[model samples]
Target: MSFITINNIWQEYGDHVVLERLNLQIKEGEFCSMVGASGCGKSTFLRLLLGQEKPSRGTITLDGKRLVAEPDSHRGVVFQRYSVFPHLSVLDNVAIGLELPQSPLLGRLFGAKKRAAREQAAEMLKKVGLGHALDKYPAQLSGGMQQRLAIAQAFIMQPRVLLLDEPFGALDPGIRKEMHAL
Candidate 1:
């Protein structure tokens, strides 16, 4: 079976049909790019794959299992707008997703797990070329840097599928090209 499958998918928003009988198959570890004119439902398709929206007509399957629930650990997303939390340091923002909820008292009293998560987050940030910005907040970084940080956050969890919605849309052309290369 295909790693990710969309069969006869349809989506409508009010009177508008954003996707009509759209079908797709994406293989695991394959890099695929979607290109089209505006209002072509590219972003909507991403939302559907991410389980943020339901198909009006068809089924989406991941590894042969019907996708009806949002599998938090299986998917990661990076949006065009900076999705990082403004108040947290870059390392914290990246680590937040990797941390699990412990018993409230234990979580409050323990710093070891938090430190481990931070260390992993720092490693991920370095992998995405943001190692130097670990201590900075979102507002302190440039647009390109912020986008890179977002990429790090999404990839830190090592999800099976990474959804990127026009990630380079807001960057200058040069930087956008650079990000595309990365």
Candidate 2:
């Protein structure tokens, strides 16, 4: 069975239609990419996959079960724009993902849990070449660096499915290539 199945999906916003007659099946460990002109529903489709929106018609199933229209740890996304918190340091931005899931009420981890989360965030940042900028804020970094920070933030969650929306658009060729590898 497919890992993800989109059956005759359609997306409509009142009088306007964003997507139509879209069907897809993805096997486990498979990679897929969608390309189209602007305003053509690529992001909309991604949002559906992320469970941020429900399609107007048809159904989407993940791992043979109906997909829920709510965000969960199973999926991680990096938007075209940097989604990192400008007020937080790079390390904290990434670490917050780890902290929130475990402490939804207080929205924080205390003592050793907090330290472990930060350490894990630091390790992920190092993998994305942002280790040196751990103390910097999003505003202090360049566009490409900020994009990498967003990627690190998403990756720190270790989600089952990762969705990237023009994530490398701000990166130079070298950095873009490195991100593809990472």
Candidate 3:
């Protein structure tokens, strides 16, 4: 079986059909790209894969498991809009997934395992070429840096699948190409 499968999928918004009978199979560790005109359901497809939305018809499965809800840990998503926490430093933003409270009281008093999470976040930031911006807030970075930070954040979890929705669309052509190369 395919690692990721979208079988006979259909999606609608009221009377408008966004996707109709779409079928795709993606193998594990494959790099795939989908290009089409604007408003052609690309974002919808990503959302479906992320389990942020459900198709009106048909099935989506990952490694033989049916997707019926917002998937946990197994998927990561990056969007054109910056999803980083504005108040957090780059390190904190990238480590948010790994810092879920062990206990509400412990998190409140001890700050959620900062050392290890920060180390992992730093490593991911370096991988994405944002190592120098670790101390900076999202507001302090340029658009390209912010996007790279977002990429680092999504990838730090080492999710089984990554979904990107126009992740480089906001950048200039030059920077967009650079980000694509990373």
Q: By lDDT, who's the top model here?
A: 2
How high is each candidate's TM-score? 0.87, 0.97, 0.88
Off by over 4 Å in 3: 101-112, 170-182
Q: Write the per-residue lDDT of candidate 1 for residues 49-131, one digit (tens) a residue.
A: 88888888899998898885564678889976758889999998888777744334343224797778888899988876788
Task: Please rank every candidate by TM-score, starting with the best.
Answer: 2, 3, 1
Model 3, range 1-182, lDDT digits (tens) per residue? 68998899999999999999999999998878889998999989988998889899999999988985876789988986868889999988887767764434544224456777778889889877788888889999988788888888888788899889878866778767766776
Runs of candidate 2 with Cα error greater than 4 angstroms are none
In the predicted model 3, the residue pairs found to clash are none
- Candidate with top TM-score is 2
Question: Compared with the true structure, what per-residue lDDT tens digits does model 2 show for residues 1-182?
Answer: 99999999999999999999999999987889999999899999999999999999999998998988898888899988768798999999999999998999999999999999999999999998999999999999999999999999888888878898999999999989999988
Of 2 and 3, the candidate ranking higher by TM-score: 2
> Clashes in model 1: which pairs?
none
State residue 122's C-alpha deviation in candidate 1, in Å: 0.9
Give Cα distance to truth, residue 156, candidate 3, Å.
0.7
